[model samples]
Target chain A: MAGRATPWLIGLTLVLMAAGLVGGLWLAPPDYQMGDGFRIIYIHVPSALLSMVVFAVMAVASAVGLIWRIRMAHAVTAAAAPIGAAFTFIALVTGALWGKPMWGTYWVWDARLTSELILLFLYFGYLALVHAFPDRRTGDQAGAILAIVGAVDLPIIHFSVQWWTTLHQGATLKLSGTPMPVSMLWPLLVMMLAFLCYFAWLLMVRLRAEILRREYRARWVEKI
Target chain B: MDSWHEFWTMGGYARFVWPAYGVAFVVLLGSGWAAHRGLRRALARVASRVRGGRR
Candidate 1:
């Protein structure tokens, strides 16, 4: 399905990411409250958002694979697991870096933070389970179940700031209204789009390889 | 030059700011490269099968 569009997607992602870097690191002005430290929001928000989005993708694909017994669906779940883990790790690390100066600690038991951490662990567990079984089908089924269950944490993580008095800040650019000035907001939005595209590029490339791997023994594998 | 210096300094939050961005850079680039490598490995196997026949 991804075919030749993969290269073009990668190129576009690179361009968008570079533009995001410039917009974030240079064009966007410093925060009045957090000062330059708040620039971390550019990376933090995008990676954080992407982590959840990746998990949602993995969970949905896992469910489809389990329900319909689709080989390609399982392949998608397998390919997305590690990438989702990577994104989650990025989010946690960047969040910690941003936290130290603002919150007086690198980590805390805040609802948002803890839930996001659990999300990372869920990704890890899913990846481990997928490869654990000697029989690949059993492994995929087990991982899919776990992914579906863990997806309950996504909304918990998202709403934690509102539900609890966490060290993490509430949404800065809500659909209702943004507290941010145009300069800061635009870069953050660009960075988020860039990261989303980055995930898309990664997923397409990975799924291609995954599909090939899963179908390697099939007769159709030779023709492609 | 002064404003540029201020920008880099992150208004004195440079320590946190730079590391945050730096780690992000390493992770994103590394993951993308890894995915590309995996794709190559998968494709290379396909090409190899044509020459040597399936294992």
Candidate 2:
């Protein structure tokens, strides 16, 4: 099933990403205040959003694996960790780049920035814990527990801008609609969708790999 | 042609803007490549293991 779906997912991701980039870079008007520097938000916001979303996914998958002893659920947690970490890294680097022009610094020890950085570390911790155990089952269980525990950071990361005075700005895209013009907003929306598709594609690929590794001795694996 | 140059300049913040996009592109592409490579390696390992077990 995954084998058939992977190509379609990759194709969709590429198309959407290209469209999003063209729209953001050319069609969208520059910000009144930040000018073209604001274009970084096209990628930064999507990466930031995905970093949290992927962690939430990992936490939920970990919980499911713990409760039901589902190996596939654990595999999902494993598959998502490195991808989530990558997104978090992108979010930080792009954010720093955005900050230097707008905020006049590459980084600040502010609430929003700090919490997001913590998220990157949490991903690292989960990956390390999972691999540290000699036994695969023990490793999965330990990693799942760590993932569940680390989920507390998600809400903190989300509300940090509101809860504290920070150089980092509040959410531009909100459920209540944004003050941004339609021209700029549409491309961001497209980019967000593209990132989601990219994540799904990567997840499917990694999950397949994780499953194969775990089940290499099984009869089904031999058939594949 | 000058218009294209202006687009690339990104309104004088080209240094900041382009690098941000560049980093995102590299990280996303790298991760995708890594995931694909991992899948291929796993497949190869499984194939060898299965053959060995049968023999």
Candidate 3:
């Protein structure tokens, strides 16, 4: 079963995390502009990237749930909401930490910042909505609409730095080999992989929990 | 000790840097544990009900 793979996946996550943390913290060179403080990018970038990635997961699942009336699809959206929220929180705080030294303020009315904050609140709203009704399916319907609507913020968050004069920097690792050097790039790629692995482990665990909750009395529960 | 202190300092952004990683680590691990524990409890509940129903 999928959940059986979780322990191994989590083990992989831990091992990769230790290596990536070392690579990110000590091996990666300081940025020319930000000095050693720029090491925060290792965590910040992955969290920020995952925040968007998780939302995309939530929105897609919600869409499929609504379209197909699939209970499992809704379960995925529900499971992903809080995970996505945590990632958004990490992104926000780390962004502020990096911002204070670089932009001279912990926050601003920057379009990117505002859109990302809205993303956090969207996750919160979706989560709250998912449990509001006595019938899980009803709540799932409501959350699906919100997740789809809130998805508009994703493109806004991605392009905010480009679309407006924002303090936030644009994407660092474009495919063109344009911006960052190889030394800085490897840790980033590793950290991103680590984040995905961690998310996968967590998601599998959450999915089984959701299944058990939804199907606790079913005979299949005893077999597992 | 001196090199350790320097590493901990994070080039003087220790306050911001450490908390960021700390929060992420805590939340990630905490949530994973919660899911694992939740599953165990739910399964136990189902098992108990199954046994009781059989009797």
- True interface contacts retained by model 1: 0.78
lDDT of 2 by residue, A101-174 (tens): 89989999999999999999999999999999999999999999999999999999999999989899999888
Q: B1-55 in candidate 1: lDDT tens per residue?
A: 1377887787878999898888988998999899989988988887777667744
The parts of candidate 3 lying over 4 Å away from their true place are none
* Weakest 10 consecutive residues of candidate 1 chain A by summed lDDT: A213-222
Candidate 1 global TM-score: 0.95
Task: Indicate the residue-level lDDT of A63 in model 3.
Answer: 93
TM-score of 3: 0.95
Taking every candidate in turn, the Cα RMSD to the unseen true structure, in Å, is: 1.7, 1.2, 1.7
Superposition error at A107 for model 1 (Å) = 0.7
Angstrom error of the Cα, residue A205, model 3: value is 0.4
Q: Model 3 - which docking category? A: medium
- Candidate 1 vs candidate 2: the DockQ winner is 2
lDDT of 1 by residue, A1-224 (tens): 57677778777778887887788788887676787788888899988888999889888988898888887888888898888888889899999999999988999999999999999999989988988999999999999899999999999999999998977889767899998888888888888888888888889888888877777666677787
State each candidate's clash count: 0, 0, 0
- Candidate 2 lDDT score at position A80: 98
Report the alpha-carbon TM-score of model 2 versus the true structure: 0.98
* CAPRI-style quality class for the chain A–B interface of candidate 1: medium
- Candidate 3 - chain A - TM: 0.97
Candidate 2 accuracy as lDDT: 0.94
